[model samples]
Target: MLYRRFARPLLFRLDAERAHELAVSGLSRGWRALPGVPKEDPLLAQDLMGCHFPNPVGLAAGFDKYARAVAAWPRLGFGFAEIGTVTWRPQPGNPRPRVFRLPDDRALINRLGFNNHGAGRTAGRLARHRRRGHLGRVPLGINLGKSKRTPPEEAPSDYAESLKHLWPYADYVVVNVSSPNTPGLRDLQEESELAGILDALAAVNRARAEAAGSAPLPLLVKLAPDLEPAQLDAIVDLALARDLAGLIISNTTIAREDLASPASLAAEAGGLSGGPLRERSTQMLARARRRAGDGLVLIGVGGVFTADDAWAKIAAGASLVQVYTGFVYGGPGTARRIADGLAEYVHRAGLASISAAVGTAAEGGA
Candidate 1:
């Protein structure tokens, strides 16, 4: 109520990227003072990809690309937070005015181009958080991306370098070949290219596990929502063949149809996210779930704004769901509200646990 009625209106007045930076900086500086969300119910708890999530709702990757706010997530009520789309090399992203809001559509269009302080810097930050025990109570996943200057053929090595640098600090790593901002980044989603990258990361993961005497870190790929059915199936096949941990069902969509926002806003040249993406993302998730069955973990993202949306994703086959645009529009209380509502939904549906709800709708449809 406070965020929507008061904070949002005020924040909305600022430039989109500026408001984001301010919010993140404020949270990073004063997170300890913010009240934590209520304890999650056991029904909402989930064990996926070897990490125990206290709740299924998490903050998606783009919001904290630098991992600067690592400790603020759990306190803000998110079950987990995936940080970074950090590249192997530091690069200034696309020019300013890269982020735009579609308030009328409750959406966002951004072409920030994986702008971050780089993988090594992000790893160093996470290292400091680890030493201080400040990473909050939830799992932390690092989303890895190729350097903008790295050519398509060199993507595997680029991504591998990032994994090597950040391995120790990440609970899991998301291979991001899905963002629409970077030139030819989405092209890495092709079967041969994606398989090579996964293979490289898997080798590094094994070596790390042997050296550290810990379990091999989980590796999941984040896919673009724009993929064709055959492309998605091929990716799933490669994931299974390579023994990957899971997939983040989507990054953002390049499509521009069915938006309620102004024509000018819809004409922006970046991935579109929010209410308009809900149906497409959910449908893709359902398809992937049916193909992958119970063998893979799927984290649904895109257009999730409420418990009902999150629940729909879970039922479609996402063991976990993430929110980005929704968090921006809904504010700090969003995760808690969604988690609480999901627990109630589970009870009302007479499901034993959140896992019981996974892929139920997809299975019924099949």
Candidate 2:
């Protein structure tokens, strides 16, 4: 309520990218020193991918690309926080005015092009958090992307390099082959290409686990929202084949759909995220759940801005839920608000916990 009336109106006035920069700047500074919020509802807590998430809501990748605010996430009520879309080498991303706000539709279109400090710098920041004992308060996830200069064929090595550098700091890692802004980046989602990258990552993960005498670190794949049913199924197969931790069911969508924003802004060339994305992403999650069954964990993303939206994802089979564009519009209280609503849902449904509600509405699972 406060954020919408104050912070959001003020932010909407600033240039979109500038506002996001200011938000990250705010988080980076004052967070490390404060004690975070304690756990909320026990009903919302569940163990998945070897980590016990205090709740199912997580800050999605692309929000904290630099991993600068490691201590702030749990303090703000996120169950986990994913940083980066960081590459092996830093790049400026596509030129300015790359993010557009569609206030009418409550959506955003961004072609930020995976802009971030390279893995080396990100790892350094996470190391500082680790030294301060701020790490592992909530599970930390590092999302990897290819350097803009890397050819598609070399994507495997590219992702592996970033993962290798950031490995020590992350409880889990996401291989993001789904962003549409980077030329040919989505091509990496092809079965043959995806399989190679997953294979390479698994080999590296296994080696690290052996050295530490622990199980392999959980590794997940984030998908594009526009994929066909067959394509989504194929990726599920590859994830299982490679022994991945789970799948993040989706990145933003290229499809415009029936958006209420102006055609000029709606037609903007980038991935569309927020309200316009809810239905399609939920459908994809349900479909992927049917294909993977009990074998794979599915973390749902895309267009989730409220508890109703998050509940839809969980009912459709997401073991957990993540939000990106929604956070930009909804404010810092987003995760806590969503978790609070979810607790009501579990109680009303007579379920013991949120885990019991997972997949209760999927096509076949129900």
Candidate 3:
């Protein structure tokens, strides 16, 4: 009640990226205050790709570019955390003023091109956290992207390099071929190119699993919401046929249609995320679910800002869900509120477990 009525409105007054950094810093300090927040009813824990999630709400990548907040998240009540869209080399990303607020649309647009302290620095941070035993029970997934200077044809090598170096620290690895801010990266989602990338990583993963005497890290493909239906169908078919672990139903979109932002702001060059993305992302989830069927897992993400939004994704076919903008907008209590709300919805709907709701509505749409 306090966040929705008070904090959110005040935070919305600031420029989006600055507001985001301020919130992350404040939440990192106040995470311990969460235990005293109301506990939502317990929902069944989930197992995805041989890993257990305490619950289904996950912090999407981009929130923690350098894996700086891993130890603070579990206390914030998220079931999992994914950090980075980190490149092989550290780059400043796009120019300042690259991130913009679309408050009237409750959305954000950013041309912040894959900026980070690079994969090596990120790995060192995680290694420090691991040695100190600081990463909480929540699992971690690392999102890998190609360096800006790497040519499109060399993407496989770029991603492979990331996987080779960062694999040991990540519970899962996401091939982020879809962020629109990166030039030519989305083109890699084309079947021939994507398969080559996935196939190369799969080989490395298989060997790594054998060498470690355990299962390979679950590999998920992050996609763009801007894809056409035929494109989406082909990608799902590829995932199923190739036996990839799963799909993250979307990344930030390039489209600006239907936004409530002023015409000038709407014309900004970048990807859009937050409230305006909810319905479109859910539609993509539904379409992908129909094509992928029960054979592949889906992690729904895009514009989720409330528990109802989260529930809508699960019904559409996401076995798990993630949030970036929602957390930015909804504040620290967002995850707890969504998880608690979904748990109530599950009980009221008479579903035995949250998994039972996955794609229940999608079957009809399918």
Candidate 4:
């Protein structure tokens, strides 16, 4: 109520990127003063990719692209934080006015193009956080992207280099081959290409584990929502074949269909996210879950604003749920509210645990 009635109106008035910067700055400096959410219900706890998450809600990649507010996520009630879509090298990203808001539709279009401070720098910052004991309790995953200047054929090596640099700091690593803003990035999602990338990262993960005498870093892939069913099926097959950790289910969509926002805003050239993406993303999640079965872990993202939306995804096969644009519009209480709502829904449904609800709707058992 406070966000919609007060904070949102003010933030919405500013330019989108500028408003984001202000929010990030404020959270980074004052996160400790923020109120904590209710104690996590054990029913909501999840053991995914060998890491124990206190809840199922996580902050998706792209929000904390540079790891500036690692500690703030748990305070704000996220079960985990996936920072970065960081590349092997830093780039300025798309030109100004790259991010725009469509308040009428409760969506955003961003072509920000992985504008982080590069892998090496990001690792340094995370190291500092670790040294200060400010890394928070929830697991931290790093979403790795290929450098823009790196050629398509070399994407495997490009991604491998980043994993090597960031391996120590990440609880898990996400291979992002689906950002629509980067030219030819999505091409890496092809069966053979994606296999190569995953293969390379798998080798790196194994070497790191052997050297450290620890478990290999769990590796997952993020896919684009605009893919055909055949494309998605192939990727799922590759994930299983390579023995990868799981899939992130989706990135933002390039499709602009059925939006309530004006054509001018919808016509913008970038990936579209938030409320308009809910149905499509959920459908994809259900399909992936059906294809991957019980073996693969899936994190459903796109257009998740409320507990009901999160529940829809969970029932459709998402083991975990993530939010990006929804967090932008829903304010600080969003995660807590959604987590609490999910726990209440689980209780009402007479389920043993939140995991019992996964895929029930998709499997026709709901």
Candidate 5:
């Protein structure tokens, strides 16, 4: 309440990126001050893609671009933190005025262009974190994508290279074929192209699993929200056929029509995320559930600002849900509040388990 009434207004006055840095730095400092995060009920615990998570709520990728904030985030009640979309090589990304806030619509538009400190640097940082015992108990995933200079034909090798570097540290790996800010990145979602990319990654995963005497890594493909139903179906079929783990339903959208922001704001060139994206992401989750059948694990992310929003995603076919803009809009306690609220929602609805409610709202039952 204090944040909604005051802190946010103060943060909004500064340049968005500057404000973001300050907030992250402050959180890191505060985590050092506290003893540790408090324990919570097991109602929030879950298993997805063969790994167990203490809770279903997670901080989505892009929040901690290079794993700098991993230790502190677990204190904030995130069951997982996906750090990156890190490329094989680091680049400066887009110029300033790249991030914009649409307060009227409770949304954000960004053309950040996958800026990161490279996967190798990120892995080095994470390895150090492990040595320092900063990983906490929360699971971590790494999202990988193509560097700006990389061409389409070479994209698979680029992603594979990143995987080779990051796989040792990442509990899971996300193939980021989405993101509107990157030119031609979404084209990787094309059936033939996507298959080739996954095939290459799968081959590497098979070798790695054999070496470790374990099962293949949990590999997920993040999709763009703008895909048509047929495209979604094709991707779902591909996921199952290739034995990939799951899908992260809906990445930031290139669509501006659904946003309630002014025409001037909508004219901005970038992906729009947050409250405006809720329904569509949910709709996409339902679609993926239906097409992928009962087996695919869906991580729903888009406009989850409240517990109800999280419940809506759960009931529409998401096994787990993620947030970024919602956390920014709702303050530090946001993830805990959402997780608590979800458990309450489950009890009130008399569902035996959260899994029981998956896809209840939309008929696209998972």
Candidate 6:
């Protein structure tokens, strides 16, 4: 009630990007003052990728392109939080007016181009948080993206560089090959293009873990929602072959089909995320699960806004689900709302654990 009636209208009044800046600032500076995030119901817990998620809902990457407010995430009720599509080099993202809201559709279209303070700078900040023992409550994932100016063939090293700087701080690291905003970024999703990137990351992952006398940090990939069937199959095959930790089922979609928003906002050139993307994203999650079988873990994203939406993703095969646009519209209480709702569903369905619910709605699922 507070967010919808009081915060949403005020946030909606500003330019979308400007409003995002304010929210980030507020969360970063005032986390300690915020009420403590309560423990999730036991049914919501899941252990995967060697980490225990207090709940299956995570704040998606791109929402916090920097670690500025990272400490606030678990406190705000997210089971985990991913920061950045941070690149090897810093670049001013596309132009202003790059982010727009579609209230009717409850979605966001962003062409922000992975703008961030760059890997080294962000690693430094996270290090400060680490030194203060503020880096953990829930898992932290660092999402790595290619430098916009880096050549396509060199994307492997480009992504690897960011990982090198940021890995120490990540509970897991995600290779972001999706995002419609960056020119040719999506192309990196191609098996040929992606194999090299994964290999580079794996090499660094092992070396770092060995140096630290710990297990290699889990590594996952984020993909775009617009991929064709064959493309998804080949990519899943490749991921299993390379032994990736998991996959973030999707990023955002370029297609604007079936939106309630006006054509002007719908036609904006970027990825469409939120209510409009739920169906396709869940469908893709099921497909990937089928291909990987028990060999891979999946994290579903795109258009999740409520317990029902998140549950659908899990039943479709996501071990966990993430929120980007949903958080934008659902506001601060989003995580708790979704977690509470999911617990109700778990009891209603008579499930032993939420993990057992994975892929239940799909053919040959759990």
Number of the top candidate by lDDT?
4
The digit string of per-residue lDDT tens for model 2 on 74-154 reads: 998899999998999988899999999988888899999998999999889888989988897889889999999999889
Model 4, range 1-366, lDDT digits (tens) per residue?
999899999999999999999998899889889877457689899888899889999999999998999879999999999999999998889998999999889999999988989999999999999998877589998999999999999999999999888999999899999999999999999999988888899999999999999999989999999999999999899889888889997899999888888899899999999998888899998898888887799999999999999999999999999999999999998999899999999999999899999988776431
lDDT of 5 by residue, 1-366 (tens): 888889988999998878888887777656786446648556667778878788788899888886787888878888788999899998888988888899888889989999898878888999998998887478888899999999999988888888888877878899999999889999999999999889888888888889889888899999999998899999999999988888997888988766567899888899899988888888989988877766788999999998899988887788889999999899888988998898898788887667788777767332
> What TM-score does structure 6 among the candidates reach?
0.98
* CA lDDT of each prediction against the hidden true structure: 0.91, 0.89, 0.84, 0.91, 0.86, 0.90
Q: Against the true structure, candidate 2 has what lDDT?
A: 0.89
Q: List candidate 1 segments past 4 Å from native.
A: 364-366
* lDDT tens digits, residue span 1-366, model 6: 799999999999999999999999999999998888776678989889998899999999988898899878988889999999899998899989999999999988989999999999999999999988788788999999999999999999998888889888999999999988888989999998899999888898899899999999998989888999899999998988888889998898999898889998899998888989989888899999888875788999988899999999998889899998988998999988898899999999999889889988767432
Predicted candidate 3 versus true structure: per-residue lDDT over 135-185, tens digit per residue: 647779999998999998888887887787788888888999999888899
Ranking by lDDT: 4, 1, 6, 2, 5, 3
Error of 5 at 365 (Å): 10
- Alpha-carbon error at 366 in model 6, in Å? 17
**Better lDDT candidate (5, 6):** 6
TM-score of each: 0.98, 0.97, 0.94, 0.98, 0.96, 0.98
User: Candidate 1 clash total?
Assistant: 0
- Give the C-alpha miss distance for residue 90 in model 4, angstroms: 0.9
Clashes of each: 0, 0, 0, 0, 1, 0
In Å, residue 199's CA in model 2 sits off its true spot by 1.3
Report how far residue 42 has shifted in candidate 3, in Å: 4.9
Q: What residue runs in model 3 are displaced by over 4 Å at the alpha carbon?
A: 4-10, 27-42, 364-366
TM-score of 3: 0.94
Q: Runs in model 6 with CA error above 4 Å? A: 364-366
